[model samples]
Target: MEFRLSEDQRLLVETARKVGERFGSAYWRDLDARKAYPAEAWQAICDAGLCAIALPEEHGGSGLGMLEMALAVEALCAGGAGSTLAQLFMLNPIFGGVSIARFGTPAQKRALLPGLARGEVTFCMALTEPDAGTNSLEVRSFARAEGDGWRLNGRKVWITAVPQATKMLVVARTRRVEEVQRRTHGITLFLVEPDRPGVTHSAIEKLGTNTLPSSSVFLDEVRVEPEDVVGRVDEGWPALLEVLNTERIVTTAGLVGTVELAIRLAVDYARGRRVFGATPIAAYQGLQFPLAQAHALGEAARLLNRKAAALCDLGEPYGSPANQAKLLAAQAAAQATERAMQTMGGMGYAKEFDVERLWRDARLFRFAPVSEEMVLNYIAVHDLGMPRGY
Candidate 1:
């Protein structure tokens, strides 16, 4: 795999970095404290056309690929805007736009995607239920066929960007579990207008990522029209899986960037702060080694993420590579953030230094989108050809 970015990709990264740099740590800290969406930052990204890089040209985007998307997100996080900026910018395109571009009818694409490209609309994933967090195959949200439409009834939890989203790509069961020959079958995808009647949501108070809201969505017999279906009925599992690699790859890139930023902050603090006869702590091997090790791990994770994203852009099979990248990047971010905390000591714990905020955001990746244990399980079963354990 090539280590260097293409000229265009480099330009894209530079543009994203500039956008991110416009928002200072004080801006993010205030928003995180208020648990409010970074509306101004999000609008800046949209206005710069970064949000639509992956969309097709006809829909007013650059018609780029996953590699370009990942590059932009990485730059955004590395510029100190962190993962909320990345998620708010990319979630609609990677999760919803890709699915629509690939599977939607021409009418569906025309009706929804242009608004997405213009950032007039935001899309959130409404997949996880109270009982179906990691194991989405067991999702109990049911959509029953109605007269030329459908009626959805269920609850979804841990849905990101709910407050800011205008639409949702909702996954539901069309057939009962016992009726399907396999667990993956009988699932369906629907494009839902979230503000319509019978649809209600509340923001979840979480440990981190306060700049964006996670929500619990209640779909109480919400009506969906026939044109809103993303793919063929009872075939949503494969459709959802089609975009999982995109989601994982972009997220891995952001995590890598965040970890790199943590390492940079730690190293800078260690070098400048003097202790014990005016000696820089960075001179001590004890403080230096862990940060160095974290840097190595973060670089390795970045390489893996690059490879996975490149494969995605090439239209090659990238599930294993993307999953592995997510696993490594999450671990690397956790370690790097923790090391940054230890190096900065009390200052790191304080909000002004920004390491504490970065630390909280970094830890979210270890579980959300996909857990580390699940990635290992996938590697064990698919890569190693072992019997499924769970």
Candidate 2:
């Protein structure tokens, strides 16, 4: 199998790296401290067309595959803008626009794709609720049939970008819980506009990744038309999986980049900072061994991420690969960031150094996209011939 990036992919990676360099740790730190969105950095990424990396050429995108998208996100995170712009841009094509492209009507595509390509409109995936974190089949949100339309009533928590999103892909139950044979059935997905009278959002206070605002959204009898249905009514579980799987793979790429950056920073600091002797801390075998281990694990995770992305680009079966990639990469990132922080000693705890921020941001990966435990369960049941745990 091929192990290297193509010439065009390499060029895209370089472009993302250059664009990301404009917004360094300082900028991200300021935004994080102020709990404000990184509008400038986001606009820069959009102006570079990074947000359109996965859209088709017909949709005003570069027509790149998920591999190219992963490379671009990796480059962005490697340049230290990991916390602010990676998720927004990297997932734009797959999570934001792909549903529309794959399942949207011609009119929907014509109406939404161009603005999304230009970053004029933002989309949020609304699936997770307070009661249903990992068990998405237990969703309590309901979309009842109205006069040739639907009225949705539900509450979604920890929804990213909901406050600023013009539109959202909301997963709700169109049929009652007892009406379906499988809990996964009878669910539906809709693209809901939050400006309607029945929708309201409150921003959540998060410990990290503060650049993007998340909210608890309440939908109270929000009216939607038949045109708003994505894919099919009571068949949205599969459509939502498409987006969530893409999210896992792409987010893993960003985490891989963050781990690489943390390793580099730690190595740089360890090689320069003198301790008990005339030489630097790099002379310490205790520190050197862990640093090497971190580098090796990060590299391994990176390779897995690329493999998953390649499978996605080829339209192959990617569910298992994507979960594996996310699990490995997130673990690697968390370990690498933690080691880097420990290697930096007291300075790592300080926000001025930025390793601490990387540590905090790296942590969200284990819990997001899919939790580490969920990945393990998926592997056990699907790959190991074991019975399903959940």
The segments of candidate 1 whose C-alpha lies over 4 angstroms from its true place after superposition are: none
**Residue pairs with backbone atoms closer than 3 Å in model 2 (clashes):** none
What TM-score quantifies how close candidate 1 is to the native fold? 0.97
Off by over 4 Å in 2: none
Cα lDDT tens digits for candidate 1, 1-390: 467777888899899888877876678889999988887887788888888888889978889888888888888888886665667744688767888988888998888888887778788889888999989899999988889888999999988888778878899999979898999999989888779888999988889999888889999989999888888999888888977768897788888888878888888899999978789998989888888888788788888878887887788888998899889888888988898999999999999998899889988889978899999999999999999979
Residues 1-390 of candidate 2 have per-residue lDDT tens digits of 998678887888889999877887788889878887776777788789888888778877888777888888888888976634567853366657878877777888888888888878788878889999988899999999989999999999988887677788888999988898988899988988778779999988877888788889999999999999988888888888888888876788888888888888898889899978798997888888887787787778778878888888888888887888888888888878888889999998998878888887778888886789989999999999999755
Q: Per-candidate TM vs. native?
A: 0.97, 0.97
